[model samples]
Target: MTDIRLFQGPELLDHAVALHSVYVDAFCAPPWNEDAEQAIEFLGSLRVAVRRPGFTAALAFGGREVVGFATAWTTLAPFPTDRCYPRAAAGLGPERTVDWLCGAREIDELAVRPQAHGTGLAADLLEAVAEDAPDGRSWLLTSLRSPRAMSFYRGQGWTQATHPSPDGEGIVVFLGPRHPAGALAAQPL
Candidate 1:
């Protein structure tokens, strides 16, 4: 059986190495194909991310080994310009970006070790971090390159808010099930 725990603020750093291992296991293979440098960079970013307002994280452990994890925080106003934030904002436009995303809970990352893929651990971790989201306003951005990931979130009831390019090779934004603007998303062709 897997045990899941929630951590808030910088306290999450206590298990940094273990969490990094789970991250590498979940993302460095197959469709993701991320490298060691990217994993190291994630560690560095986690340090800063944990300090963001409303930051929360959930980790799944099996016999003292981390098998999955998820992180989230409240999105602030003006919207960010870095990372994939710009892509999300561009897709939603300035008005919806601020009105729908700002002040909402933003799920930053969710990863489950390959061995734990079919065990429902990913969904548990996602809910653990987002359980307290304000008004159930939550959102996330995922790569369209991974059809499995896209399917997983959709199966979890998240609504796809952004339409990917014809080649389906870009970031796609998803609004959590209860997001007020979920009905505003454009249906895919």
Candidate 2:
């Protein structure tokens, strides 16, 4: 039997090792094809990210062994000066980006081990992180190249904020339900 647990920032910090292990196992395959270095870097990033306000995480375990996990945090205004944010804003448009995404919950990561793929753990983890979003706003970015992943998000009611880019190398942003950006859900591809 599997168990799902909701964790606040502090608890996430406490279970960092388990979280990192599950993350590496889940994302190092297929579409992600991440290296050990990338996994280590993700752990480093999580260390800082959990400190952010409104950070939340959900961990799935099968008798003490983590099988899946999800993490998210509220986006702040002055909007993250990150490289990806700027590019995302370009695809999503500055108005919708700022009005709906700023101060919203951004799902930074969600992964489930290959052995558990057929199960519904991913959806449960997603709901755990998003259900309590402070502003009832949530969003995430996934590669359009991965049809399975995109299908899963759509199945969960997430609307694509950007269409498949002509270059075919860009990430697709998804806006959760009730977000103002959802109105632009059908913007031209």
Candidate 3:
């Protein structure tokens, strides 16, 4: 079994950097690397998610080195709304425009080191996050173009939602029992 720990303070920042590095190696997506500005943005988002309430960051270590990390939250704002609030709430009254956000769990981000990519580390990281969540529907968004990524969710039995990516690209949402094997129902160890 992989050892996991709850991240605190700058610990999240450290993982965010590791996550940034691995993301570049795995995807080479422009925004993930070769773009200093984009890398900064990506790291900023990761740092934010790790610090949010009900949000937990899990890092896996191979004895002495931090090989991978995943971060998620117990609540999420609905799409369009979730995506827009950070932009639209610039001037609206907090009691008004912000009221729409309530009672939603969000798996904001998850990334595994390229060196540890094929070791089932990603699934284990997600499983740990799910294990900590209270019984309830949860959701995550993954690139639909990446069949491997999509398959990973399908294996976990995530249901497809109607929401499509703003870019018109496929993006599927998943909400299901934390565990299909019934292991998730067991008492916390």
Clashes of each: 0, 0, 4
The residue-level lDDT of candidate 2 at 76 comes to 90
Candidate 2 C-alpha lDDT tens digits along 1-189: 889998878667888788878888877887778999999998889888888988889898999888999999989987886857877888767787788788999999998888888689899999889987755689998886578988899899888888756565678888887566677676653
Say which candidate scores most in TM-score. 1
Residue-level lDDT tens digits of model 3 in 62-143: 7766676667775534323555333333322344222322343556566666677678888787766666555554556665
Q: TM-scores of all models?
A: 0.97, 0.93, 0.68
Determine the backbone clash count of candidate 3.
Answer: 4
Model 1 is weakest, by summed lDDT over 10 consecutive residues, at: 162-171
lDDT of the candidates, in the order given: 0.91, 0.84, 0.57
lDDT of 2: 0.84
Pairs in clash, predicted candidate 2: none
TM-score leaderboard ranking: 1, 2, 3
